[model samples]
Target: MKVVIFETDAPLPIARAKHGSYGDMFKALLQRAPSFATAGPVEYIQLHIHADKPDGDVRDFPPLEDVDAIIITGSRSNAYDTHIPWINQLTDYVKHALAEESKTRVVGICFGHQIIGRALDLQVGPNPAGWELSLTEMALTSEGETHLTTAAKEDNKLALMQFHRDIVFPPLPENVTTLAQTDVCAVQGMHRPRKLWSVQGHPEFDTEIERELLEYAAGTGMDRKIIDAAIAKLENQETRVERDRAAVADAMAAFLLE
Candidate 1:
């Protein structure tokens, strides 16, 4: 399997915060994909772009056609930031990926989801009231239950590790369809035609990272009581690391084989 990973500034060797480390998550994801280790030599590439290295320097990278699947991760930067240097290139990358004829699969997580939507003609902006942190419920829309279930291992809710400030609200592309939505956020999960998929939460984070995120969020401008409640609630939430890793690996494997 050929997988291309787009890293959004967080888990690089040099980082301001240690909570968003994804290198371990990527290894875990590969291990979770039952076919990954045993499959005919899996190829995984990491694409880095962050505040420290805004240039993104894709000059040494291989041609896009060599990739069979793409995974774009979230960043601390906002998708609507017109001043960000890499924003345009990132948007173009999404548009090009979606427009490819080789059935190239793309998976966007968090900032990746928002940027992909914007590239596909959707408007991405702040939540106005702010964003949801920690674990929250994403009540599946009827459509969500049908198609999104393909990624689920069993019949139950999929609670992901979420940390975002911007939300997506514009209409999806003609070829796209909604798979899930929460009371506060629509398009929590979406699929493009049949090969591409994206989710607004983080399925790559482990238990330690999740806890770190919750603690960090609690200290922000959030109300003391509300933050306390969220932290308390997080204590009872399901870790689902194993389940999520399996689901993501399954989805990626299926996309590649198809």
Candidate 2:
């Protein structure tokens, strides 16, 4: 299968040194799925939306009909920020892609999730509860239990890696069903039938990358207490990373192959 990744941001220098680019991280995460492992060969095309060409404009993206599936990567840029023309263009591109075809499945992670929410006219902005950093426990909704192939079937709750200050607030768009949620963020995962699927957490994140991120955040002079808490949470929940990665990858594979 052919997949196009819309990369909105590059990884921090510290993290990038260890894990490579965000596109590489996502490719590694998705390849962990058993289905993807045996699905013959898969081709991935990465489009960096954060960069502008010599013409001082973001490069035009390929049409939705040209690929089997699309995955939008997390970004530091806020979806609601109109100052960034590329962000607005990317949001419009997502809306246009979904509107043009129903067969192309799209998955959004973190900033990507908020972008899709904004594209659908849902309220996407900062969370009143503040940043949801490090590892977090998310409970599956009834729809999640019944419809989500990504969740652990035997367990109602799953631990996922999260790093976001923004959220996709209710009421969700028509036909959209929330799959999972946490106390801090009401919309952790959502599916809009055959068109789109999105999750607030970072399935592509691993312990090492998160550690680098924490260090990077510390260098930024963010609150030391927040960094320490994130470190503690990361250390405590490190074991669950592999399990969550496999579950999410399986779900993504299923969505793409469906």
Candidate 3:
């Protein structure tokens, strides 16, 4: 399988030291999927469209037919930001990819999720409730139950490691079915049949990565209470591996393959 990794931001020092890069992290996570077992060799092509300033060019990219999937990694920048030069450009590209007929399946995480919403002309901004960080349990909607397969849920809720404040707002496009919800964020996930799938939480993030983000937030002058609480939640979670990571990976892999 040939998957294109669309990187929106670089990883922090600690995360990079362990995971190499955001693309590397996603590749590692996807490899955990059972589908990958029989899928043979996989090729991950990283594209730094935002960082490299691609200037609205697709000629340099591989033909869409060759791409099995495109996973958009989370970013530090807001999806609705007007200052970032490439934010809109990325949105435009994603919009085109989602709208046009192609073999490529698109998946978004965090900023990637919000950018997809922006592309669809839905509202994107901070959650009115507050930031949802660390290991958070999200209740799956009926649609989420059908589309998002996971055995890690208790009371029909799955725990995912998260670190984001902004969200893809409600009343999403009519074509997409909302997957999950939390008190803090209503649209925890959304799926558009075979074309796209996305989650607000970071399925690609491991314990080390989530911990690094929490500590990084602490140093960045984020609210002491928020940082401390997020750190506490991380510490309270089960050992090294998260319980739901594999389930999420398999779900994504199944969607991408479909």
Candidate 4:
């Protein structure tokens, strides 16, 4: 399978100790979904858009005829922003891929999820209470579990890495179904019958990557007490490697195959 990575945000240099940049996170995701492509066979491209300058032309990338799948990564900005130049184009592209006779399959994470919602006419914005950033347990609904059974062979419970202030509300699109949910968020994962899907949390994140993000958040003037508390809670913490990775890989593969 030929997979194309569409990075909506850029991570700071690792030399700066900013930790898992968008590229790094996606690379880890690909590691879990190894069946999707060979080593270095996955093509990665970037769209650099920030608060200051959020517009760019993506007309030069490979056409849909050459793509088997297109994965969109999370962004630091909201999907409702009017500043991001390529935001509308990205939305249109996703909608088109899922339209009749399109081969490009899409999977969105974090901000990517929000963008998918927006593209499909669902609303996405900040949660009334604010962001939820922690290692949390999410239970797969029957539909979620069924999908997992096709793609996953390990534990049913998933301990996910997450950090998002905004979430989708009022349920998903009419054609979409909720696969999983936590106490905090309802739309953990969604399936549009077939051809497109999305997950709210970061299944691609590992301990080292999460640590880097925490450190970066601290440096960015996020509450020291909050950061310290979160770190302490996550102390000596190591994610379960095999089961979680396999589940994610399986779920994604099954969704794509459908």
Candidate 5:
């Protein structure tokens, strides 16, 4: 399968050294699924959206039919910020892809999730409850039970890794369905039939990378209490980090294949 990774931003220097790029982490995580063992060869194409600063443009996006799926990565930027020209460009591309008759599947993660919500005319912005970091338990809705066909099916509540402050608010698009929810965010996951699938958590993040990210956030002047909480949560054995990572990967792989 030909998969296009729409990379929104690069990892911090320290984190990148330890975990590689987000695209690299995603490739490793997706390959963990047993189905990938016999799914034949898969090709990944990384299209870095923020690489060339002043000249960046989404008009150069590849034709929809050329790839089987498109996965948009989490970004440090906010989706609701129209001041950033690239955010608008990326949102436009997503809208165009979803509106097209082609069958290309689109999966959005974190910032990507917010971007899709905005593209579909849903409210997406800062969360009133602040950032949800580390491992968080998200309860699956009836729609999730009916639509999700991977590791997420094993239980009603799945603990997945998350690191974001933005959220998709209420009054969702007419065609969208909420799949999962947490106390902090109402839209932990969502599906729009065959066109789009998105999650507010980061399936690509493992304990080690999250630890590095926490340290990075700390150095960046984030609240000390938030960073300490994330650190303590990461150290907590009850988080079951590995299991959550696998569950999200399995669900993501299944969705893309479907």
Candidate 6:
């Protein structure tokens, strides 16, 4: 399979040193696909959100015919930021790609999730309840179960890592389907038939990455109370839950390939 990954933000220095860029982390996540071992080989191309070009066909992204899927990586930057030129450029690209492309698939995470919402003309803004950090347990709608179960080994609630303050709200486009939700974010995940899939949490993130993120967020003025509570969840093994990361990856793989 061939994929292009768009890295939206630079990772914290420590995390980047250990995990490489956000695009690289996604490259690693591709292995979680159920067919990876038998799929022969995969091709991946990386692009930064900052690298967008104006020309359509020969712009930042490869032609849709050349790629099977496009995945947008998580970013520390807010998705609703209109002040940033690259942010607007990326959103416009997504808006056009979603409307014009039919053969290729798209997946978005966190800020990327919000990007899809913005592209679709949905409400994208900060959550009134504030930031969501650490592993968040989320529920899948019946439609979600039907779609995601095709790619999952077993069916159950999802527990994925989250580190975002922004949320994607209602008035979804005609093609969009609400897949999963949690207490803080109603749009935890969404699907658009064979074309697009997106989520507000990080399936590629682990506890260690969250640890690094918590500190980094604090340095940027995120409240310590929120970070401390999230930290406790990571430290308390008794209540700790393993994320259904592989299951999500499996679903994404099936979505991109099918």
Worst 10 residues of 1 by lDDT: 12-21
What would the TM-scores of all predictions be?
0.82, 0.91, 0.90, 0.83, 0.90, 0.87
Q: Model 4, 40-141: lDDT tens per residue?
A: 455555444433346655455567778777777777778877566678777777778777698888888888788888877887788887667756667887
Model 1 TM-score on a 0 to 1 scale: 0.82
- Per-candidate clashes come to 1, 0, 0, 2, 0, 0
- In terms of lDDT, which candidate is stronger, 1 or 6? 6
Task: Tell me the TM-score of model 6.
Answer: 0.87
> For residue 161, what is the lDDT in candidate 3?
87
lDDT of 1 by residue, 1-258 (tens): 677777775653323254334644665565666666666776777777755665444334445588777777878778777666677777777777778575567788888888878877788898876767766657665655554353452554566667787888847767777766777787787776546777788777655566665566566765677666656656744545446545656654554555
lDDT of 3 by residue, 1-258 (tens): 888998877888988887888898888888788787677888889987554443333335566778877889898878898566578767776777787677677899999999889988999998887788988888999888776666544467777888888998889878898889988799998898788899999888877788888888888888988888777877746642355777788878878877
**Clashes by residue pair, model 5:** none
Worst 10 residues of 6 by lDDT: 50-59
lDDT of candidate 5 at residue 147, scale 0 to 100: 52
RMSD of each: 3.6, 2.4, 2.6, 3.4, 2.4, 3.7
Candidates sorted by TM-score, best first: 2, 3, 5, 6, 4, 1
User: Candidate 1 — which residues are off by over 4 angstroms?
Assistant: 12-24, 35-38, 54-61, 146-156, 218-223, 239-241
Which is the winner by lDDT between candidate 3 and candidate 4? 3
Where in model 2 is the C-alpha error above 4 Å?
A: 51-57, 100-102, 146-155
lDDT of each: 0.67, 0.80, 0.81, 0.69, 0.81, 0.77
Error in Å for residue 7 of model 3: 1.4
Estimate the overall C-alpha local distance difference test score of candidate 2: 0.80
